[model samples]
Target: MTRFSFNQATANRWPIPDLVAGCVAAGVTRVGLWREQVADFGLEKTAALVKDAGLEVTSLCRGGFFQTPTWYEENSRAIAEAHTLGAPVLVLVSGGLPPGSRDVDAARRHVGEAIGRLVPATVEAGVQLAIEPLHPMFASDRCVVSTLGQALDLAAPYPAEAVGVVVDTYHVWWDDTVWAQIGRAGRERRIACFQAADWITPLPEGVLLGRGLPGAGCVELRRFREAVDAAGYTGPVEVEVFHADLWARPGAEILADTIAAYEAHVA
Candidate 1:
């Protein structure tokens, strides 16, 4: 459990104060936070809270959506925020197809360009802009980069320190080529952050919050972990399940279960 980190979205309703306290009580040293939630709690204050509690903000949940009009400004701010929070990586959900556009190729090309524009700012902040490829089911509306290989391709042009990719089991488990892609991520030095969440189905329409705890589904959590480890990733493994029912319970209860699942399935 030394490398175990909890992702805040696992308890979307958990207030920042309580989540910090709960992690401290459970001996969880690291956490993955989200932008909206951090903004809600006041960024500077949240930084002080975690610092005071001896908790490390492993990586920020997100900071990319190139399709938006103000993407440059927004991503710049996100990089700054990650620096303030002591998070080394700012995870990027590389956005989805533009409105009324089926031309995925165009959308992906735009994403690459947008990310390149943000690389300089990332370098200045000393934070890695971590590109996360969402499950293909979310391809139409959430993320167009649907594989580790594609993420690595986009990150290739930038220095490894400036750009990297996120390896989240829930998103990449179904792809047969993931093992090879992970090796490429290592060789290219782009494996920035590794997250874990089991894959479950009967996916709610839109499929955003359909994740399960580590051992609750069919995903090969250990295999993904080993692959990323083999790929030269030695960072915190954040458990990030986003399910309505899971979030409804008390934050402490959820953390306890998440810990158990991680030990049983992912450790």
Candidate 2:
């Protein structure tokens, strides 16, 4: 059975308690959270609440935005937070192009260096850093890790138990090399998270974040499933939609609809 989970990014405005409550109420078996919510609610309390509800936290929203100065401190803090939540994987969004740095290659190098420094801490905490490749559209402002291939390349140096890549359909559906990446990840045993969402045309308000449900758009999620399965990954196909319109509806309504959509399309 495909287990369902939602990224806290969907509930952009709701409190952490409310989001966890919503996930439980929605019958979602798993939940993923952002750093802000974790910090605001405090990690121990957040973990207790979710565990008390008997939910599996699929992964923590992130760590890693390789810039300078406080970058190391920030990454270490996120890794520690992941441990507190008991989340097996810590999703990492590599930082964007720094100012006065037209050299994307340089920015990428910085991301690589940062990951190297952070890997030890992640390993010590017994948390896997799941590198989440943002869409190419977000290459400038969000993450330089913009493709599964790129993310995998970064993961190559670390132990699979300590570092892996998050395969989110929303980010890689449009990539010409997705299948190859999936196959490689499965073969390498480096898949830590597998999430899904639809890709619609003309995009949406937060287009970089993704919009719609599985099979609701052009993403070949079944194909993605097939590839992942072939590579020997049987993890939950977490539903991480960031639709503004969906968020406007009641959380329960969204959850019910998401369950239906997962069954109809992803399963």
Candidate 3:
């Protein structure tokens, strides 16, 4: 059973109150919250309301940026926010190459170091840091961790229970080694979260990012599901879409369509 949840960024405009109301109305039991929205609504209040509505806080939206001297405070604050939201998994986008620094490996090391410092705080909060491997296309600016293999490698040094990986089909589907990595993640028990989106046409203004809807693209999701089931991961199949078009529609419409899509394609 793949439970479904929506990423708050999909409805970037709505307040947390409205977002929760919409998701509950649509029968969704979980959501991924962005740091900004959490702050706006105040974490404790938001958490209480979400609990009242019986919503599961799937994971926090993000917690990393391309390595930079100024990011430490920001990242630290994100960890605190994740705790405030009562989310177990904190999704990290291990930022891309910094200016004048073309060394991809160095950039990766920088992220590792940054995360190393935050391990204590995350542990204190009882939250697992989920390193999300963004698509390779965003490697230059968005995230350096672009493959499940690489994400697993980064988490290998830590206790697998505290540090794990998020498998988003939008980013990993194109990789030839994705299936193997999925199996590896399951075998290692590092698959903290699983997300879906479809590859769509007319590449948006930005690079071809997060375009898949379940069953809308060419990726064999059933096979991926098999690997996940084999590995014993029965968590929510979180729907994280950044579609420009989807954002413009009413939250109600988006929720309705998302539920329908999940049943028709991902279920």
Q: How close is every model to the real structure, measured as TM-score?
A: 0.98, 0.93, 0.94
Per-residue CA lDDT of model 3 for 1-267, tens digit only, reads 237778887677778889999988777788988888887888789989988998889899788894767688887787787787778898999989998888999999878878778788888888889999988888988899999999998888777768889988778878999888888888888999988777766677765444655766676666666677777789888877777677788888877777777777777
Q: lDDT of candidate 3 vs native?
A: 0.81
Q: Which runs of model 1 end up more than 4 angstroms from their true locations? A: none
- Candidate number of the best TM-score: 1
Full ranking by lDDT: 1, 2, 3
Cα lDDT tens digits, model 2, 1-267, are: 336677776656667787778877766778888888788888789889989998888888788777656889988998888888888888888888887677888888888778888888998999998889988888887888889999999889878998899998888987899898889999899999998788877776667545787777998887887788899988777887887777787766676677788888887
User: Candidate 1 or 2, higher lDDT?
Assistant: 1
- The total of clashing pairs for model 1 equals 0
Which regions of candidate 2 are displaced past 4 Å? none
